[model samples]
Target chain A: MNLVANFGPGRPRVEQRRRRGQTPRAEILDAAGELFTTNGYANTSTRVVADAVGIRQASLYHHFAAKDDILDALLVETIAAPLELAERLRDVREPTPARLYALAWFDVRQLCAARWNLGALYLLPELRTERFAAFRLRRDELRGHYETLAAAVLAEAGGAGIVGAAALPFRLVEMVINMRSDEGSAPVFAERTIPEAALRVLGWPGDLDALRGRAQLLLAQLEPA
Target chain B: MNLVANFGPGRPRVEQRRRRGQTPRAEILDAAGELFTTNGYANTSTRVVADAVGIRQASLYHHFAAKDDILDALLVETIAAPLELAERLRDVREPTPARLYALAWFDVRQLCAARWNLGALYLLPELRTERFAAFRLRRDELRGHYETLAAAVLAEAGGAGIVGAAALPFRLVEMVINMRSDEGSAPVFAERTIPEAALRVLGWPGDLDALRGRAQLLLAQLEPA
Candidate 1:
């Protein structure tokens, strides 16, 4: 069960007037984010968030229209950091496939773990309602950004001829992220397993020490050539 | 929610005498399997399965102790076919990595789609219970078989030194199977995508037609000298 699945919907909603210098909205969002992460989206209720903040549920509603609104806010904040990193990596001059692959993989891993649903909610259609469309669109946009970054890098690295090879890095990264989401295993298992698997796919020497050094070398190679 | 979740310790047990001439047990299982596939495991109940077989719920209970037993039976039947196939494939003399990988990919795809709950059930903790441990153990055994097949093929192909290379084919196949389990996409998409992805990881051309011919050629290359 996901953290979101544990919280039942329906919380008391009492509006609270903000003081001249305070941001009650931010407080409500902060509480919701913690609950969603620790508990789960499904199991969390607005009342829980309000109670955590020592505010009425109505005040929480005043800050956000629904529980999904809280989720949307969390997603935007959570996903934005990695999306920014991906964007910065895309701007690197003469990017090599290996370098770009590593950057994107690392970025997605960081973002996936930070989000409570681990990005599955964005991909799951049953969860994709009109309210959640913005989150989905943002997620898709980030995906496209990563794909474009990969394509550019593959082209630079002389591996462009392989059909879907450019997109393989992104797909592999997503696969690793999904594997980490499995309840049976610890994230450490994936952390060890995925990079080795990915390095092999990228045609690197799969030795961890070699991979780390070679990844650095590949990044250096991508510098303004 | 799973059928197993609906069954608790408080439920009453009833003993029944078995009649050799009447195979009500098998009939109920057959009906339940069909209903579970079409209506989903959560939506289908013991009563529903009983109705399909023209029997009362009590008679259904006479065959299987609970709905979870029905699920366990279905899983055992579902997973056994694929394990058998893997064993048969493992016995093929002089298998190449490409041939072994392709065959494994095709076999896993077929099995993943055939058992509607196999992937989803893996996500459920109830399926990991002691009573259902056989299902998981069988799955692990099958995975070990595939890994061995891949390692043997890689060793024969003289590419064992590629650094994590020995583990690549198995990881690729596993990733593809995981993707196929996602409810959003069609099985055909994964079937096509995974093999091509596997070929690329194996350092083969990614074109599907090219892969088919190349896999055969690679197998021939691995034949005993």
Candidate 2:
């Protein structure tokens, strides 16, 4: 059911992905993601997205039947990779805190990767509508992933079972939405620090710096494929 | 210069501040804050706010010259209080961590206090307009207060100065924007825990439980007035 499995920055053969002009469908979705981020979902119509892509408005319908479908594709593009990481982390065996760090690290990386801070769109009130139900479902699945991992981390650390603790750390990972760091510092800072901050929040008793280095290494190891 | 200096929950006789229907202006602001939170700033016209208060739309202009004026009032009402607390915190001579905790604790209380979570309205795109510029400036001042305190805590604790550490904990304190815990548990949980979590993120070296109790007392001391 999860179409985004193995989809993300580390995907093999990243260069083979379509160039903007070479593939009209991918180009259209690219334009839509940009428009939705700038003008918002309600203000961005299919015609605007088509024009932005230098494609005819009529042809936009061939690739996506409706405007909401384009929005769905945008949401899926931004979210699916995080969901995939969560899906992997939720079922990980013992030493789950380390695995959770990997998930959080990967998630924080995605939040900062995009040229635009697309995660800000997550706060739009319109996303609550019935039309975005699929996106909502996937987002909830992501929440479940965070919550499952949080409960285990709290339990293992012998911390009080604070309801909604998962949310704070998950929000920390999602901090990239509002975060504005100097361009040079962002990648190193996020990779080096976010998991440490989250682990401290979780009362993780292990060496935080050591754990962060390991998480970085885990992601880096998967990078060279 | 700080219009919000005499703001927040600590001020004596908060109940004596206004009585319902005592003045049309107060009634109008209460209505506007509610309408803005529900229907959103852009969608809710002056007429709608007037109708909500059972006043003729033309009469609304008498109290506030423009719709954005009403929006400014609502923003001031919700935000002035926290800025006041931050203003107070920034000047405390010593035990700066303790002061920071007080500011954060009071802020968290304000976030959970209202019948509706007016803080969520801060995310609306309309708030970015030039109309709310003054409000935005004051909001940034409050952020500065938080950042100043965070820098002190990090420095005292000998933690590495990450580029945006101030923002993470600040956003952590602002977590009430999205938090929807069970109604009965909301106050006790937020009042009891958010400061501790934020301190943990800030790497505060002090005993957390003692600091939380102190923050509670500092706020409680102001309550009987």
Candidate 3:
């Protein structure tokens, strides 16, 4: 007998309802994320997000307690992907520092793309309370995750000898990611210029090569010479 | 003094009234800049600034017109200081690239301290509008000023050969200034770290004890044997 078949009366119905509930919840979050990124958080409203998802604002309330909750969920989902990627890289046996660093970079880039509104959120102190604690907590966790990876890379790459006095490559990555998340001006230039700058900072040999080549060179440096 | 004594009837009285009016206008900006930096642009009110200056909110309108106008005045003053400094540096006959770079760093640090809210203003798209056109224009002008300085420094340093990558140093300086303006977290570390990073990126040697020695070495490299 299947485990599903062994369920009591209404249990299957309850499970089906739960799954149904999740789809729209996820849909609302998707719409909210898009709106929050396009319009500044202060300017975005609950009604607008509901409209984007083709639902009543009251229906949105059933899923999200408030707009802040939607932002919290977005932050959680946005950061979770990169955190998981970092964890996965950490668990990989015999992973080179370069490979790990590249993974970290890609993870951050993905996070930047997914939650571009985070820049505005980070700038505003008022939005960082109560329900939004999770956003800050997850962000801190992400920073710690990247810091660990950067420390590992530095350890392998002769620790400050390669990156110079500022140990700036790490800071450069952080700055570039922050800059890319900026929606106000020249975002396209930021997106293009930052990755190239990151490659240069990593001491990758070639000038503006394919992403794979750049990653390989950077990661190879983290391996034992 | 003779011309003033021989002036038409009431000219002195009119000039005195105009000067009195200017005092409150300047006072409004000083209060606004202080309030905006300590408590963010959105959180600040013209009423609060007026109260701080011991004037009625309606009286503030007599001096400034609107809140955005006050902000525009503050931003223009904030941006103009650095450009003025750059101009002063330019007048000195062919200041060495190292001196020019150092001056730029010092000028930016001063401005960062004076205008911490400018970072928050730039990050918030809600603040950008036709009303804040002066802010945007001055911001772009500041960037152009940096680019022009970078070009001069690169040329003086004999281009990319001596500087490794001429554009990289300028980018590093920009990153340092940006990081310094971030008041939310690790500001002190960012301030200390970025200037040293800029010096290193400029290939001016990493040892703090040997800053003068390093500058000399860099100059020799720029000037050649």
Candidate 4:
């Protein structure tokens, strides 16, 4: 069943024709992402993912030892870019609203544009198990960043924030995942409309039109070229 | 496993013992709701549900022809009261914002207070199949009510609604499911914070405290005594 093989031990270059990624690992993730999001994580087997990628189950194991590993890898991929952006945005010399808007914009774009609706898998009860603790912690860290930025927005508005107010901006961004689930895809306006709504929920009395322009500039400067 | 029999045809009261619900049907739904929310719908078999309820598999089938039927029943249960409330709230002579807040308040309360986090099951990929079409339609109708009310709120503010603005209130209320999943429960502040955020996102240029008082009165008057 080997389409191509690399001459190495343990590193077995079993490139059985690229499917979605440049490597076998990527192909496995692509297949698993589809199955986990569509057929469900509990119902999809490692063998099914291997078959979808045209690789032997053992070869699939060479990259990811278990189905959980594939899921973990996919989850990490979703948050990695945004987490990095959130980290970088923290030090940028921009207004709090602009920074928050940029983070929401980047996050919503990724959630809506991903090949699979991976965020829909976030509620998989399996995630509660200890195996996914690292993923959970990383997600929490991302949420923490959102809270910090949102708190700044509330403070800038000179309004004492309501309970859970800081959390709403993050939640507003999360709505795109459910919206995508229902509508088959996110509406084109989601990228703009969601960020604006995020700021509004914080009672940001600043000019949104001005905020949007600055946020777009920050994104253009900070996003990887 | 039967503890008691109902003495009827097709309605065999094989009520071995009640776990949560009083009737055999209600008992099945309770067990299924727990299993589906915690263990996941795909992994929980009808036999497992019956075992948990101390009933025979045959008895379970007598009540629900298939597993999907049980899921459909549970999903319908989650939406039934809220949908009815939304319908009743539609004609109430309150201000548009108060009606929207009340709808969000009622919806979020149920989502948080359900015996099980049944709303978590809403994302199951199996739900996309034709078997659950009725549930999907019913849920959509509920969303339509939210959108109509939200549109009125936006229009009253004279802020021409942004694309997809009307859908945010429903999405905001829906966030409680994910919040519940993350924290293992929704916090006490969720009911008030979420609905307020829903209105804030729509730029409801009105006094929230006054609106809250009105919405609470509406709930008191309209919700069954």
- The model with the greatest lDDT is 4
Q: What is the per-residue lDDT of model 1 for residues B115-199, given as tens digits with 9 covering 90 to 100?
A: 3434433433345458777776886776677667656644554653333344444445555434443333334545555555554
Residue pairs that clash (backbone atoms under 3 angstroms), model 4: B3-B16, B6-B13
**lDDT string, candidate 3, A109-219, tens digits:** 654555344544555544435656666677666666655655554455453333332235434544543444432332433433444444333333333435546555654
Off by over 4 Å in 2: A1-22, A92-94, A160-164, A180-188, A220-225, B1-23, B160-164, B181-188, B221-225
lDDT of 2 by residue, A1-225 (tens): 312222222233223333354566777878876666655556678988866765556667878889878777777777788787676555545376777788788887777776555665665555666887888888778777877787788888886434446656676776666553212124457654677667767777677767767766666644311
DockQ of each: 0.14, 0.23, 0.15, 0.74
* Pick by DockQ: 2 or 4, better one: 4
Error of 3 at B96 (Å): 5.9
- Tell me which residue pairs clash in candidate 3: A98-A219
Per-residue lDDT tens digits for candidate 4, residues A1-225, read 556554432465556565688777888899999999899999999988987887778888888888899999999988998899999999888888899999999999999989999999898989898999999999999999999999988888778446678888888888888988888998888898899888877777777788889989999999743
Candidate 2 C-alpha lDDT tens digits along B71-125: 7777776678778667655554647677778888787787787655666666554
Cα lDDT over the full model 3: 0.52
Quote the positional error of residue B112 for candidate 4 in Å. 0.9
Instruction: State the C-alpha lDDT per candidate.
Output: 0.54, 0.66, 0.52, 0.86
**Model 3, residue A197: C-alpha shift (Å):** 4.9
Q: Tell me, by DockQ, which candidate is best.
A: 4
**TM-score between model 3 and native:** 0.66
